[model samples]
Target chain A: MIIRKIRGLFNHSVALVASLIMFIPVYLVVVNSLKTKVEASSMGAGLPTTLNWQNFAVVIERGKLLTAFGNSVLYAVGATLIGTTLAALAAYVLSRNRSRFNRFIYFFIIMGIAMPTNFVTLMKVMQLTHLINTQIGIILLYSATSIPFSVFLIYAFVGTLPRELDEAAIIDGCSPIRLFFSVIYPLLTPVLITAGVLNLLGIWNEFLLPLYYLNRSAYWPMTLAVYNFFGQFESDWSLVSADILLTILPVIIVYLFAQRFILSGMTAGSVKG
Target chain B: MKARTYPFYFAGGALALYLIFFVIPSIMGIFYAFTDWNSYSTEVNFIGLNNFRTIFSSGAGQNYLHFIRNTIIFTITTIFLKTAIALGLALLLTGGIKRLSYFHRVVMYLPAVLPILVVSLVFKSILNPATGLLNTFLRNIGLDFLAQRWLVDIHLALPSVIAVDTWRGVGYIMVILIAGLMAIPDEYYEAASIDGASGLDSFWHITIPLLMPVLTVTTVLNLLYGLKVFDIVFVLTNGGPGRATDTVYTAIFDEFSKGRYGMATTLSTLLFFIMIILGYFVIRLMHRETEG
Candidate 1:
């Protein structure tokens, strides 16, 4: 019994130590971002000696950080709307039918993961279409990419749903659009939220597509703006760290508020991702 | 008749868009890979195996093969370590180690929510040879021998970058494992205990086998991402320390930046084939295991 108790204590401490080690990188950024350049250069993991909030202020001022933040918010919200709606719509059709066409289409969408890296010709196509460098263009591209997983995921859940629900609404004199919005849409809210949260994070965190397509600094998304800040001051560790922390803070805050659906949605996607 | 056609109308708009934007582009990426399609040139010519030969032969892209090797190393090693740690931690968090599960989850998961660029910036500063937090602490405690130039040193850079990536990624794996564990019924462990099974025996016999499908899926996805890694490497080393950390994708990006469009597409195609083949097998193997 004594030996078991000793082993338990040892295991507890080991786990605790290991976890703390894992968390050091996170804690380091949070603490140092609050410090002045002098303090940041010193770069201790402890609290700032002077308790400076000016680091964030400096990053905000130098980077037009609010404009970038607002731009990202606008871009992410729009992209999420398109992605989730397209996904849900495609899912609805696939779920309601037992046709080979639907299955083939559904499977085809997952290939987006396989081959959709940066395509310069696609950029040229966008330019020729006169959609290049516009927020709408970026949103359209993002939504297109979001379809596969969305359809795949929503199809899995939507299949378990009863078709009679749609029929019941139809008997009550519902138009096709009304039937979707009123009857079926409400039923999809949980999965929609799952898909929405996933889309929201995905669109918000995406940097590559935006980097290629959106070149205007005034319209640059949050990631691009932060990356630009890093570029401008490649050797300035203090300013770079400060900007990095500021950029990640909003996402982390939003994530804390919606942690539940994020994990489950992400896990659900991972099993097939 | 209108109702019969309603479903087609509903799926038509999104399906058309998906096909045009996704399906067509994917096929086009492969076709372009075989041609000498430079963005600068007005007309492109066919370049058969020249681009591929460059990757394996000793020349401009020889380092990409090294990057491929590094990426493979990072992916395989990180998956093994992250899965082991996540599983053990998930076991502990599922009421075994007792209490503070919520607090621990939030702390561990904080990294995953942060963007990769931000994570890289944080680590780049944190891993500096002088006055960086990692080395400072190591030196303060009289463990100076362990300190090295982390991201800049050829010997230490790739491993150091992988370590940071693993740190950010473990929470994701742990959360998924926890979800997988939660789905398993509690009665199995109770029944096993009643059969005089040891804790280790019950874990190995009941818990591990049930978690196998999720684990397989997790490893596959993580490994694929690890192999095709671009963002973290782009922001962290950008194939620095004399191109020691160059992954094939990063090399492609450099080639693209240099206006070597045809060569870039060649590398991209190579990556596309490698990932697709590996990803297909892993997904099939996992799906089969889950169904069986």
Candidate 2:
């Protein structure tokens, strides 16, 4: 009993130390974001002598965060809706039919999960399509990039759903589109939500796409905006921290709420369970 | 009836978008790799083996091969580090300590959820050589000699980048591993114990064998993510301290920005083929798992 107790205590301390190591960076950001310029210069982990509530306001005004925030919302939401819906439709038919061609298409699309974006040639395609520096272009790109993983998740999910639902609707003389929208689509809620939330967060946190394509600040997402803000205010740790805080605040909130789905979704295909 | 119920056009939207944006560009990149496609001129000249030769030859200042070496090192190191640490955490949380395990898992996984840019930027501040938190704490603890330049030194830069990335990524791998660990039945261990098998023996016999599939999945995931790593290295070092940390992706970006489109496409094409070949095996493995 004494040995077991000692073992338990040792494990607990190890877990605690690990968690602290993980949380310290976030802790540092939270504390330094509220400090004065001089105190925040080093970006230390010390507590603030006084909480500067106005720092957020200062960052908002100077960082153009409002526009960036709106743009992020637009991109994340717009892309999630389009990407998830299209992926579901595609995954459903491919899973249901199981034809040689459909199977080939399914593999082809999901192969993108491992495929790296050839950005240099993608530039030419973007210009040819006249999407370079456009908000709509960014949305389409995010949606396209998201299709691979979304399709993979939703494809696996489509298998768990019985095919009887499809036959039943067909026997009722329902149109194909009607059967899908009215019956099959509604049953896909859980997977849709999982795919949607993951894509939302993924698109929200994305930096590379914007860095390569979106040159105009008017269409910059929070990630790009915060990066630019850091470049300008690199020395001002307080303000940079504030900018980063505001940028990630939404992502943290969403993750906390939808973490159940996010965690399950992330682990879905990797583990059999 | 089959065609009518599940119309082929339903898949058309995703197929079209993917082909146009994803596939076509990659195919075009293969062609562009052999040309002197640049922003300097409208006419793209065929420069057959020149770009490939440049990457292979390693001229006076060009370190294309070095960049590839750095990427391989980053990928291998991160995979080993993340897998080992994550496996330990998974075991600890699953069997070692039962209390507040969920809370601990959540806290650990927080960094993976945050933007890599944010994490790298914050790490930039923490890793500062002078008056930085790491150096300050080291000096305060009377270990001043232990404090060294974290990101500036060429030899230390890649390792520092790898360490920061490991910190951000281990939790994610741990979550997947926790699931894998939890799925193993308790009976296996109990049976082993009854047979007089020691703890280490059972772990080696039971847990390791059972967890092979998940381990393979996690390793492949890590491999893919590591090969394409850019954001962390970009924000932290930008392949800095004299290109000591430039990976393939960052090197591509550098070439692209320099208007050397031919070289950029060549490098991108190289990674593309490597990933596609690896991706082929990965998809086969994953597909088999789902099917079986």
Candidate 3:
């Protein structure tokens, strides 16, 4: 009995240690983000003797911080607004009606998850649309990219919805758009919020796409701005850390505020369940 | 459901965008995969598998193979470690472990919620070969010999990426599995305990079997994620230390940045094909499990 208890205790400790392991690096981020440059270097994950807000100001002011924030907000919101509706419309059609396009779209949306960002195609698309350095360009790209999930999530959720509501509306001589706008749109608010939030997190924290496509200095998003600001000086660790922290804070806030919804929605949206 | 043409119009607004945007480009990508189309060129030619040929023929060929190999390596390692660890935690979390259960879930998922860029930069400092916290901890524990170059050396770079990745990601896999466990009933456990089954025996008999659905889903998700990973690699090594860390996507990024559009598309095509096959098999496995 003693031996069993000891072994159980040992296993329990190991599990707790494993859980702790997940936090150490994050602690590293929070800790190092607060330190002065020299202190950050020599005393990694150490605190700064005094607080410094200059790094954040540098990122926000000269680093075009407000513009980046505005771009992130605009692009994410724009993409979500237009993209989700477009996807939901397709999903409604696919879910409620039987047609050749339904299967085509079902297959198309599935294929989207499999499609990695084709850099070559992305470059061509950008040049073709003059999206090279514009917020509209990025918004369009993000919107197009988001259709797969948006369509799929709405498709699955819309499948569970009763058709009597739509049929009753049709009996009342409602147009298709009116039937959808008045009936389906409000019902899909749960998934709309979920998909919108998901797309927002992805676009808000996006880095590489903006790095490649959004090359104009004025149109830099939050992610590109943070990365660019970080590289300006190898020795400016405090500024770098501060910018890094700033880029992260908005995302963290979003996650915390909507944790339950985000958690369930992500699982519902991603899992085959 | 009533027979209605209205659904078509509802779907029409969406189908136009999907067709014009996603469908056209996807097919175009496959077509461009076979061309000699450079981004800087005014004219292009049908290469007829020449790009694929070039990818295999060039010195960069071996690097592509190495990336495929390393990706498989990283995916398998992390999946194994993550699945085992996540299931273990899921079991414990379902055990009603007092106040720490909620705290553990919150603390554990904190890293997963952060962007890969944030996680990568923080670890860059924490694992610095010269003056990082990890090595400092190792030294203080009187294990100086245990330290090596974390992200700078080829041998350690991939391992470092996996460790940092596992740190940020295990919680995500864990939470999903926890949800899986919670969905499993308490009666099964009570019934097994009444049958004189030990905890390990019951977990093996009940928990593992019940969690297989979650397992298959998470594994496939993890594999898809691992195969296309660009941000972490881009930030951590930039496929550095003699290209020891290059994944297929990173190689494509490099080619794109270097103005080799056709070649990047070729790599993307190969990646898509490989994933389609793997994802199909995983789906098939899950389908079979569900049917049974």
Candidate 4:
């Protein structure tokens, strides 16, 4: 009994240490963000003597975080809605019908989970489509990029739903569109939320897409804004930390609120149960 | 009846966008890889195998092969490190610890939710050689000799990037492994114990076999993410310390920024084919898992 108690204590300590290591960087950022510029220079783990709340205001002004925050919201929310809705629609039809062509299409789309974007030629396509450096373009690109995984997740979920619902709706003279939106879509809420949260967080944290495509600072998202801010104020650790804090604040909030969905979505296909 | 209720056109919107934005660019990239496409040149001249030659052959001041090597090394190392550590953590949380295991799991997985760029940036400060938290702590604890230039030395830069990546990623892999571990029926362990099986025996005989599929999924997921690793390297070192840690994706970005579009496309096409092959198996595995 004593040995078991000791083992339990050891395990708890080990878990605590691991969690601390994982959190140290965040702790450093939070503490340093509130420090004065001199204190923040090293970005140490020390508590600030006086919290500099003005750092946020300075970062918001100098980094143009307000515009970036708005852009991020627009892109994440817009892309999530479009991507999740379209993926749900597509997954429903493909999973239900399961025609050979549909199967092929489903495979082709999910194969993109491994497909790396040829950003060089994507530039050409973007320019050709007049989407390069445009807000709508970024949203569309994010939505398109999100489709594969979204469809994959929702397709598995679609399989779990009873086919009786679809049959009943069809027999009641329900049009296909009406049947999907009015009946099947409501049932898809859980998976839809899972895919939406994942996509929203993914889009919010995405930096490379905007860095490659969005030239104008006005269209830049929080990731790009924070990166650019870091580059400009590499010396001003306080302000840079503040900017990063603000940039990731929304993501952290969403992750905490929707962690169940995020974790389930992540492990959906990887683990059976 | 199926066709009437579930129309094919419903998939059109997603298909169109994906094809245009995702698929077409990749196809066009293959063609452009054969051309001398650049920002400076308006005319894209066909130059077969030249970009490929440039990548394969060692050139003065430009080592495309080195970048490829770095990418492969990064992928392999991160896979090993992440899997080993994650498995350990998963086991510990599942069997070793009982109290607050869920809370610990949530805390550990927090890093995965944070943006990689932010994580890297934060590490930039923590790993700072002179005044950073790590070096200071090492010095304070009388471990001054261990305090090395984390991201500055060419020899250590790649490892540093890999370490940061492992830190950011291990939690995610652990969460998946935990799910995999939990999926195993308790009866297996009970049966093993009844048969006088040791813990190690049960782990090897029962847990390993049952967890193979999930392990494969996690390995492939890590492989895909590692091969395309960019934001971490880009933000942390920018493939710096004299190009010590440049991966294929970072090198592609470099080539694109330098107006060498053909070379960039060539590199991307190379990764595309490799990933597509691996992705085929991954999709097959995932599809089977979902169905089963």
- Scored by DockQ, the top model is 4
What DockQ do you compute for every candidate structure? 0.46, 0.87, 0.47, 0.88
Q: lDDT per residue, candidate 2, A63-127, as tens digits? A: 99999999999999999999999999999999999999899999999999999999999989999
**lDDT tens readout by residue for model 3, A84-141:** 8888888787777756756665655656665566667767766776767777777777
Error of 3 at B21 (Å): 4.2
Please write out the lDDT profile of model 1 over residues B255-274, one tens digit for every residue: 77777777787777777777
Candidate 2, residue A107: lDDT? 99
What residue pairs are clashing in model 2? none
CAPRI level of candidate 4: high
Compared with the true structure, what per-residue lDDT tens digits does model 4 show for residues B90-153? Answer: 9999999888898888889999989999999999988899988899999999999999999999
Off by over 4 Å in 1: A1-19, A114-116, A234-238, A270-273, B1-6, B59-61, B278-292
Residue lDDT tens for model 4, A30-76: 88899999988899888999989999999999999999999999999
Model 4 regions lying over 4 Å from their true place:
none
After superposing candidate 3 on the true structure, give the runs of residues whose Cα lies further than 4 Å from its correct spot.
Answer: A1-20, A98-101, A270-273, B1-5, B39-41, B57-62, B279-292
Worst 10 residues of 2 chain B by lDDT: B56-65
Candidate 1 DockQ vs. native = 0.46
Which scores greater on TM-score, model 1 or model 2?
Answer: 2
Best by lDDT: 2
lDDT of 3: 0.76
lDDT per residue for candidate 3 within B69-90, as digits (tens), equals: 8778888888888788777777
lDDT to native, each model: 0.76, 0.94, 0.76, 0.92
TM-score of each candidate? 0.92, 0.99, 0.91, 0.99
Which 10-residue window of candidate 3 chain A scores lowest in summed lDDT?
A: A264-273
